[model samples]
Target: MVTYLLDIMEYADSDQVIEVLGGAVSTRVIRHPNRSFAFEVTLDLEKGSEHFSTKPPLHFHANQDEFIQATEGKIGLELEGTEYILLPGQDEYCIESWANHRSYPLELERQEGRTVVKFLLSGAKSPEVYELNTLFFENWYKYQEHVVRKGGKIDLIQALSTFDAGGTYVSFPRWVPFGRQVSQLIGIVVGRWLGGLLGYQPFYREWSTDWQLACDKMESSIFQRRWAVRSKPD
Candidate 1:
């Protein structure tokens, strides 16, 4: 969260390093079918984040659940329709499957003159779960970063493809009744079916560190991958 500038990155072992202006994300993913032993995210927020979103879009996972524990800064967790302020070691928090949620930074808590934010992710998985991997974190953030760095807004079709691949669904406006469920169905049609027909891919090699893993998972699904979707795109 704090700071860096330049589009360069380095990946070693399971940790993928993402550096941006005044921010850095080094992701480490430990995988398993029933649980993810570790998915650590460090958000350093000082300045220079004008192009990025302060919080993720309101979204829910169809089969994945997450736990959050902050060790450095305050995290504002918006869950369902309420926002909860989470402090370091405050308590163990869990975001269940299909729970609409997003996270944002709160006031700086340490003396680093910036928010020293660190988080650990543990997931609840099952045989029915389609996506237990945490590539969603890297893929989503990296895609947004890529778009912003190019001085453009996110492409909706591309976003839909990523969400579908990650087993996530966007939430609709609060005024609409059953908006989340409605939006979920719509996302499947627009982002999954229609988008697939157009050859928009859910995982992109330029944006995904674990591209093959993501591709393999998505390929096992109902939609057949076109050659473009199956191979690395230039």
Candidate 2:
């Protein structure tokens, strides 16, 4: 399959936005060509509100490095069990390959306003890394809806397992017996087959050319109200 990565240091004219965590926030793929660099932009819908109340599952890449730049508002990051708060204009935080990490907003108090961040993923496996996330966000809600129809909660394991074939492995708690091996097996055997049947494609075909149209659509969406309001200072 062909892949594309976005150019570093280039401004994105438009971006394909996808909602996550129930429309609380959205992520846009800024650039992804068929090379080593990839870029993404994230916007928080509710200023000052937590992007996600709970910590995300721990995961790491074996050959990709991530750099995060806070464009607006502050962000909190946890890298290798250490916490750091980053304010706008601060230096970018680097997460080297194989470093266990996660990030969220630092303050969840009042409507301090929204935050915007730019993330750059690069290195030997960057294209695959970007594709893995693209696949998940693109089909996450569909997977959830499917489970809801069956009177079952979202099957995160099954949904996330789709990335196993591409090397994006999820880290389970150490206490879960054979968790890693079992999950990998399920992702490879069950997730791959099921995802194919469900029509889940890993890469976005129009991201490079249709990004401007996507950006326009997202700006006019209901979520854009938050952006408008946040533009005015408190």
Candidate 3:
């Protein structure tokens, strides 16, 4: 792990391209503070292929709050258990902490070539696991795209692990009482404990920005920090 960390550190000096979903999505970070991080995401799916899902399953942030607004075109958003289409002029949707939400591409917006949306993230919880910032999104989106481009599946354990790394927990059916708690427990055990036993990690050098950056950020938790490879300072 230390050798791999050293190998990837050579590339960390340069900025990584923020594209994902087989190049269907691009992102840029505008603000990067832990409490008020901001960024723009552009989704440009292929013509007549809006069915392709470029988003993750509905999940809830245990410690983060998300806000989204369409700046250029329309985007499909499912928030607070209600699915809706958000136009450019629509009001910013504040996804409170623990709210169930997901975002995906839209067909109607493809006519304009691309849909640009801005997102604001604030650390809503104590951030004891991981903070919601550009680094978290970097590994999260890149890993998803890596799996898609490989035309293969990354086991459920790996997926859950990444969700945990980003402070996102799988949201169980809302109808079930105490579903959120159940989901979090499943993620920590299956994604963190079992996945770690199987040598799976929440962050990978192949899909993330820098080895040390992740190592530094994940120090908030022992489980999260252990998977990030590190070396002694020279």
Candidate 4:
């Protein structure tokens, strides 16, 4: 018997990534619940050519699975008590909640010339997911501030709207790799026109009561709004 899996990224409407705080740590998510058990597949693409580029630090998904595949360039994977350097066409698979690990570029050559794609398979949504999002956004602001303090130009409008989509609610945005500039803009315009025809099936909603309260508080906060407003003239 044979089984087939789809490279769903090809059919996606958005790039499924966040570029502001986390740089190019972008992803596209697909959720499958009608199957035996709920699972999530996220394709993370990272470019090594940019300044201040780095992958997430060492950590593990509490109740999630992960599979790392090197499609265009080489990547390093540490799993099951060992580290492996994966080249193009190679993949490293790991069971969810079984190991603690992370990946990083091994050299400047690979850092500047390689593109690595990591696939994260989760059995179900995990708390670390939200934690990671918060960290990325917070740290990204720090990074932006650092850059500005150092006399680098920063986009305030773009920075304040980091993961926002101009509404009371927000979800993952359609993402496209930086290399695919035209395609990215076109995808966003097309998706807006077609109502997310190629959007992901499984979405992690951030409308929890706490999320709502946080959003409300943020909206009402004078300081936060001032910062966001100040960020807009960039």
Q: Which candidate is the best by TM-score?
A: 1
Off by over 4 Å in 2: 1-8, 20-23, 32-40, 45-51, 110-137, 140-152, 173-234
Number of clashing pairs per prediction, in order: 9, 10, 0, 8
Please list the residue runs of candidate 3 whose C-alpha ends up more than 4 Å from where it truly belongs after superposition.
Answer: 1-17, 32-36, 47-55, 109-126, 217-226, 231-234
lDDT, residue 203, candidate 1:
65
**By TM-score, how accurate is candidate 3?**
0.77
lDDT of 3 by residue, 83-128 (tens): 8876665566677778888877566445366533433223333545
User: Which lDDT tens digits does candidate 4 get at residues 1-234?
Assistant: 211123432335542333332343443333333211221222224332443354543344333454454444446676544787755454335445435466554544554553444433323334332212332333344555457458776543332223222110121123523322343233234422222233311111222112432343334433232222212221
What lDDT would each prediction earn against the true structure? 0.65, 0.48, 0.65, 0.36
Worst 10 residues of 1 by lDDT: 2-11
lDDT of 1: 0.65
RMSD of 3: 8.7
Cα lDDT for residue 230, candidate 1: 48
Candidate 2 structure quality by residue, lDDT tens digits, 43-116: 45353144255565666554456566565666677876678776655656667765667766554452264444
Measured against the true structure, the TM-scores of the candidates, in listed sequence, are 0.79, 0.57, 0.77, 0.40
Q: Any runs in candidate 4 off by more than 4 Å, and if so which?
A: 1-10, 21-23, 30-56, 110-234
Flag the better candidate by TM-score, 1 or 4.
1
Question: Clashing residue pairs, candidate 4?
Answer: 14-175, 15-174, 15-175, 15-176, 16-27, 16-175, 64-96, 65-96
Better of 2 and 3 by lDDT: 3
